[model samples]
Target chain A: MEILMVVVVGVMFTIATYMVLTKSLLRVILGTVLYSHGAHLLILTMGGLGTGAAPLLSTEGPHSDPLPQALVLTAIVISFGVTAFLLVLAYRTYKQHKTDDLDQLRGSSDE
Target chain B: MSNLLILPIILPMLVGTILIFFAKNHSLQRVIAGITAVLLLILAFYLAHEVYYHPQQTMILELGNWSPPFGIVLVADMFATLMVILSSIVGMLCLFFAFKTIETERAKHYFYPFYFFLLTGVNGAFLTGDLFNLFVFFEVMLLSSYVLIVNGGTNYQLRESFKYVVINMIASAFFLVGLAYIYAVTGTLNMADLAEKVGVLEQQGVLNVIAIVFLFVFGAKGALFPLYFWLPNSYYGPPAAVSALFGGLLTKVGIYAIIRTFTLIFTHNTGFTHDIILALAGLTMFFGVLGAVSQFDFKRILSYHIISQVGYMVMGLGIYTQLALAGAIYYIAHHIIVKAALFLFAGATEKITGETSLYKMGGLLRSHPLLGWLFFISAMSLAGIPPLSGFFSKFALILSGIQEERYVIVVVSLLVGLLTLFSMMKIFMYAFWGEQKIPTEKVDKKETMGLLKPIIPLVILTIALGLSAEPIFQFSLGVADQIMDPSNYIDSVLNQD
Candidate 1:
């Protein structure tokens, strides 16, 4: 299960990297989103898969590690906020420069 | 008061959230931010004194009264408290300077709030004792900085800030990956607990990789060489006040994290890890100065210098001796004061002549002698001239390097110092010398003085730091001692009832 999860994480990271290296601003933002999701998955996988009940003393003979789930939840919230911010920023950049192509966004010649 | 540590983090968070409501009220925002900056400064000094003089030399605050190993914690050792003090100094000065210079339109867009929020992150990063908590604070700081960088939303700013945000976002992701790996190995996120557990763990090889992962994450932030390509250009996009705050405080936070982790958590394989640090420091210094040497614009030159000076501070860390770390600490104190003043002077001169390219500016020394002389003094200090803060810090770092027989870096440092002097003089000669550019009638003497006012304290601090280098270095030696032994930090956090 861990090996399969690791392979899945690697594939996700590969896709994210390809998207991030693309020229479009929106693509770059999505790439980062995908990248963060990969990290979150890696965290869960590294924490080890559990076949147990929820982490309540009364209900569980063996309990899942609550910490990685908690970490992923916090990370998801943060990534959500960051992704929203990135979208707004990309839109603003697109509006200001009239190009979402990262190459065309190079600084002015004299500056 | 053990609780005092949390106030520095909390006050800024509270004030920042409140300031968002009053962003359109310009004078009120200024007054509130000024008062808050002053209060934070006072709090910083008091806390520094308390932490410094306390026999334990480390203060631990576990949130909600949770036990340290299992719960969130804030740890302020001598090094951490000193960083808090430094950030407060830079933050306060920059806040006042921002009051004078930041456009009302920008202020109305929640500039003051984001500024305070950035401080909240910087202060929180300095004070936190949990690895994940550091990551969270890092995001807090970076989020505000993203807002600040593109606040005015110029095309240049948008382009640069996108790069900045994406790079930082990527770095933060890597930070999480490092956290996950370290936790997977040791089953702890509390830094003290990690330190204790790692000390006993036998897998030095895996731990070494985790340390490098952290170094990479922090290197991207700290402007370490090979990872510093984003800094000079991105920094050039912001207003001088924002740049001043960032140039002095932001990268240092990365270095601070590097110093904290390497000294405390990743200590078993010093030979493997610190050697990597030393090599990076050397490259960072050489390449950073080279970047500075090639830049001609006022802000651009100073922006590149930020990358270079960060190298020296890390050089102190790379050496990893008591004396070397003390020197690094002293170097940080000096660099923060001097670099902020230099960037403010860039703003002040830009205020006068309305030019950023050094070649187009001249004869400022004739019109504004005070600005010229003060800038010259700071420029000289930055170049490591005798009897200034810069010289002593470099001297101590080099002295320790020689004792350690790390001759190559010592030589590289000396060469970097020379290049630094050359570029500083390049700014002085091109910008302050030659023919008068702006007519005397167009210059607003009062406005210039207002801009220079906040910077005067920073200048005084750099000078004061120089003159008192002996006692300060002695004090920093104590800080270094506290840092070199992770046991002090681990014990304070974990043994508390």
Candidate 2:
């Protein structure tokens, strides 16, 4: 199960890297989203997955580490916030510059 | 007094959040931010005093009463409190300068809130004892900086901010990955606990990899060498006040993290890690000054200098001695004050002449002698001239370097100083000392004075810091002592007795 999860994360990261390298702004944003999801999965899998009840109950069976789950949740929320902000910023860039091509945006003011 | 450790983080957060409601009223925002900034300054000073006088006592505040290695802990040692004090001083001056300089439209867009949020993140990063908490605080600082940098949303700002945001986002992602790997190997996230665990671990192959990962994670943010390409362009886009704050405080946070982790947690292989740092320091200084020398624009040159000065601080850490660390600490303080003052001076000059290019500006000494003199003092101080804060800090770092027989870096550092002086003199000669460029009718002395007002205190503070170098260096030596021996930090956080 952990090996499968690792492969999935690897695939996601590869896709994210490819997309981020593209010039389109929206693709870059999507790439960040995908990248963060990959990171979240990596975190969970690295902690070792377990089939158990919620952390509150006292159970005889094994319980998953609650810490990585908590960490993932925080990471997810933070990334979501950042993704939203990036989208708005991209939209603003599109509105002002009228293009999303990263190459074109390379020229700073002094030019 | 442990509770005071958390106030530096909380007070700014609370003030920033509350300032959101007053977004429509610019004057009210200024009033509230000013008062909160003053309060933060006082609080930071008090924290500094408490930590300095009682050096052995590490003030640790475990949030929600959870114990160490489990709960989020804010640790205030001499170094952390000193950073807080320095940050608040910079924060206050930036706020004051912003009041007069920031566009009303930008101020209406929750500028005060974001400013304080940035402070909250900076202070939190300094104070947090957990590695994960540091990542969260870094995100907070970066997020707020994104908003602050693009406050005006001009074409240039939008473009540079897009690049800035993307680079930082990638850095943050790597930070998370690094954290996950570290936790996977060590099964811990609290820095103190991690230190204890990693100290005993023998298989350091993965540990060293993780350390390099962290160096990259922070190097991007700190603008180290090849990673610094994003800084000069992005920084030039923001308002001078915003740029000043970022230039002064932001990269230092990255340096601080490097210092904190390198000193405390990653002490296993100094041969590999510190050597890498030393080489990077050499390249960062050499290339950074080269970039500065090649730039004719005022703000861009200063921005490159930021990268150069960062090298010196990191070099001190690379030397990894008590005196070297102390010198680095002093250099950090000195750089923050002088760099921020120079940026502010740049802003004032731009306001007067309506230009930042050295070729387009001249004869400021004839029209505005006060601004010229102030710039001369700050620029001289930045170049490590004697009787200024810069000279003593550089002297100490070099003295320690020679004692360690690291002659190459010492020579590189001194050469960088010479180059730094040349570029600064270039700015002076072209921008301030030549024939009057701006028409006499267009130069408004009152407006220039308003801008110069906020810089006066920073200049005075720099001079005073220089004259009182002995006491300050002694204080930093104490800080270096505590940092060099992390057992005290570990005991205070973990044992909690």
List DockQ, one per candidate, in order.
0.85, 0.76
For residues B82-170, could you state the per-residue lDDT of candidate 1 as single tens digits?
A: 99999999999998888888999999888999999999999999999999999999999999999999999888998999999999998
Docking class of 1: high
Per-residue lDDT of B353 in model 1: 80
Clashing pairs in 1: none
For B266-354, candidate 2 gives per-residue lDDT tens digits of: 98789999999989998999999999999999999999999999999999999999999999999999999999999999888888778
Local distance difference test, each candidate? 0.91, 0.92
Scoring model 2 with DockQ, what do you get? Answer: 0.76
Where does candidate 2 stray beyond 4 Å?
A: none
TM-score of chain A of each: 0.95, 0.91
Compare the candidates by lDDT and give the number of the best one.
2
